[model samples]
Target: MEYITLNNGIKMPIVGTGTNTYGKENKDYNGALTNEIPELVTALELGYRSIDAAISYRNEELVGGILAESSVPREELFITTKIPAREEYVSSKESTRAAIDNSLKNFQTDYLDLLLIHAPIEDKEQLKNTWKVFEEYYEAGKLKAIGVSNFRKNHLDELKEFAKVKPAVNQIQINLKEKNEDLLALLQDEGITPVAWGPMKTEAHQQELLDEIGKAYDKSGAQVLLKYQIQRGVVVIPKSHNRANQAANLDLFDFELTAADVEKIENL
Candidate 1:
């Protein structure tokens, strides 16, 4: 697996499995419907080492259930989870500690490879509060790296100016249908790793984005999507329930997309 170092100096795999189906639980996504906890184990067994989960997904424990039973050494996996919603903690440190405590418990691990604030950042005061806690965890050896999801350039900037530790990763939506260059530039400037979600255009109107890219690369839509993201130095963790899709998603190491080909697909 290819990996990139976060700003805080943690090496994270460029491609990982995202578990965000919504229908089975309170969330509005697909993972809830699939309830494919076995797939988590399957992915690990298949040789993919990174797993991204979130509290709101309500499957951390299920995932942990697998981790507890599996033999993928605690050090070999890059496990990440998120804080679902804003909690009224007295201090950011308190919030960070409590969340990590719960997450480690959920994942059945002793530490986190990466922890991200799972929503678009809103205000300076709130971010300061949160980053404070994130830093505390990092110093205490509970979290290896810290970042946010759904944050745009503006949000990244505000937090950056006051941040004690630069964000190690920013999880956002980036794919053929929507390539946010400004977002990409902003992230690249600080060496803040960009972790892309929905690299395959989930729920997008351009369902065939993959098919088109697939034809060019002689690969599946999923493989092409993941390839594009990694080519741009962005980490992507797309979710799939079908075993074939799971295998196809990670089968991207063999091929290379040219500059001309990349532009053609990037514009699509």
Candidate 2:
């Protein structure tokens, strides 16, 4: 798998699997919070080393169970979780500290590869206070890297004003249809890694172009779209419950997109 070095000098897999069930009616599947454990096992078995999880997903314990049972060593896997941007946690220092502890306990892991603020809260001071706690954990080695998610340029600028440690990554919704080029450029300027959460989501009109591109590479339309984002230096965590789909997502490094192909996708 390909990797990207964060500003903090830690390498992260450019492609990972996101554990989130947004539209499912049944939140619990096979006794887990969601269909996380089985699918996670499938992903890991398929050579997916990075797992993106969050407190809001409510499946950390199940994921931990799968990790414990898997043959893959702890050091081989990159685990990431997040803190909710609610008042109970973000507004208080002690609660924020507990949140990290809780996640470690839930995951049954000593240290997280990465941690992020799930989203930017309305209160800037509260968010800053929470980030300060993250800095403390990062210094203490509980968290290998710290970052934020769903943050706009202004939110990042606000944090930068008082931040002692700059954010290593900014997780956002970046897909074939929603490019968000300006924000991506801003992240590049700040030396922050831009992680795409929904990297495979494409509109109907754009699928034909992606399919045509994929035909040349003997890849699927989704693979073509993922390659496009990866070429632009974006980290992607595409979620799928199917093992075949998971394997297909990781099978992207074999082919290279030409400058002309990249430009065509960028213009779409």
Best candidate (score: lDDT): 2
Clashing residue pairs found in predicted model 2: none
Best candidate (score: TM-score)? 2
lDDT of 1 by residue, 33-73 (tens): 44446667678878878988888777787777777788888
Q: With candidate 2 superimposed using the best TM-score fit, by how many Å does residue 138's alpha carbon deviate from the native?
A: 0.3
TM-score per prediction, in order, is 0.88, 0.95
CA lDDT scores, all candidates in order = 0.78, 0.88
Per-residue lDDT tens digits of candidate 2, residues 58-112? Answer: 7777777787778999988899888999877887889999999999998788899
TM-score of model number 2? 0.95
Error of 1 at 247 (Å): 0.5
